[model samples]
Target: MSPQTHINFTANPPKLHYKPHINLTTNPPQPLYKPTSTSVQTYINLTTNPPQCHYKPTSTSLQTHINFITNPHQPYYKPTSMSLQTNINLTTNPHQPYYKPTSTSPQTHINLTTNPSQPYYKPTSTSLQTHLNLTTNPH
Candidate 1:
C-alpha cells in the first residue's frame, strides 16, 4: 500500500446535531409558543396538549377580555349594529322593554323574565337562539 493510502485522513467532517439551549431558571415570555385558552377555545379548538411552559390565564384580565372583543375570529365582530343593540344599547336606551321592562306587571314580569324571547333571558336548557326576525321583517 502507498504512504498516502496508509495516512489516516477524513475528507468530510462529522455533522453536528445542534439544538438551542433553554434557560429553565428564568421564565421566558412565550406569546405564540403557548396560546391563551381564549384563543384556543375561540378559534379552531385545538385538541393537542400545551407544551410544559408558563402561561397563567386562569385569572381573568380586562386586557384579555378586550382581546376577545377585538379578535376578528370572534363571532360578535361583524353585524356591528346587532352587537351595539344587544350590548351597548342597554346603557344608552334605558326605555327598551328588554332592558328596563317597565310595562310588564309584577305577576307577568317573572314569566316574561324567564321567557327566551327576552334579550337577557337565559334558557334552563341549551336552546337555539330565536331572534324573532318576523317581528321586524314579515314575510
Candidate 2:
C-alpha cells in the first residue's frame, strides 16, 4: 500500500502587512461645516412693472432685500414688509444710460463680501457697461 499525505484543515490564515505611516502632525483639522452668507431676493417683471413675487431665506435676521430695476432711470420697486433694510444707491449721468450702484447697509456689505447661500436679486442691463458702472458708482 502507498503512503498518503493528509493536509491539515486547521491552518492559520495569511497575515496582512499594514504600515501605520500616517503623518498626524502635518495636516490640519478640517471644518465640519464652512460658514456661508444667506440673502433673499425679490423678482420683478421687466416687461410689466408689476411685482411678481418676493423670495427670501426661510431663516430670520439673515435676509437681504433687493429691488429689480428694469429701467435704471425709471425704477420699479415693490414694497416689502419683511422688516429687512434696503441699502442700495445708484449714480448715473443725466444723459448716459450707464449707472453705478453702491451698497449702503451692513447687510449689503455682508452680501458683497460673502457668497450668500440664498437667492439674490440682480438687475438687467442692455449692455455690460451698465452692469460694471452700476456696481462701482451706484447711487
Candidate 3:
C-alpha cells in the first residue's frame, strides 16, 4: 500500500483599512495645557458667579453706561424715550417729577447739579445716582 499523501492549503487573511472619524461642525479638541483667552476666562467667571461681580461703575461715564446696557448677561434698566425726556427735564429744571419721585428727591437734585459735566451730555443723573446708591447701600 502506498503511503497516503498529505496536503495543506492556506488562504491570506483579509486586510482591514482604518480611517479616523472627523466632525466638520465641531472644533478640534483643545490641548490639555492650552492657555485660555482673557475674554473666555472673563466669560467663564461671569457665568460662574454673576452676582459677585455686578460691575457697577462708580463714574458717570457714558461708555460705562453703554457697556452696562450692551452686556446681555447683566441686569440693566433701559430707559424709555419718555423716561429719557423726563430725565432731561429733571436735570434742566430739577423740579420735574424726578422720575421716581421720593423723599430722596433733594439728594438726587443735588447730585444732578453737582455733576453737570457727566458723559452722555445730558441727564443720566437720576439713574446714575440711583445706581450708585443701590450699589453702595444695596438695601
Best by TM-score: 2
For 24-132, candidate 3 gives per-residue lDDT tens digits of: 1101222222211111000000011122233222211111011112112112223221111111111111232112212222112211221224323222422232221
Across 52-73, the per-residue lDDT of candidate 1 in tens digits comes to 1331112111010111122112
Indicate whether candidate 2 or candidate 3 has the larger TM-score.
Answer: 2
User: In order, what lDDT does every prediction score?
Assistant: 0.17, 0.22, 0.19
Per-model TM-score versus the true fold: 0.11, 0.15, 0.12
The positional error of residue 28 in candidate 1, measured at the CA in angstroms, is 15
Q: Residue 66 in model 3: shift from native, Å?
A: 21
TM-score for candidate 1, residues paired by index: 0.11
What residue pairs clash in candidate 3, if any at all?
none
Q: Of the candidates shown, which would achieve the greatest lDDT relative to the real structure?
A: 2
Query: lDDT order of candidates, best first?
Result: 2, 3, 1
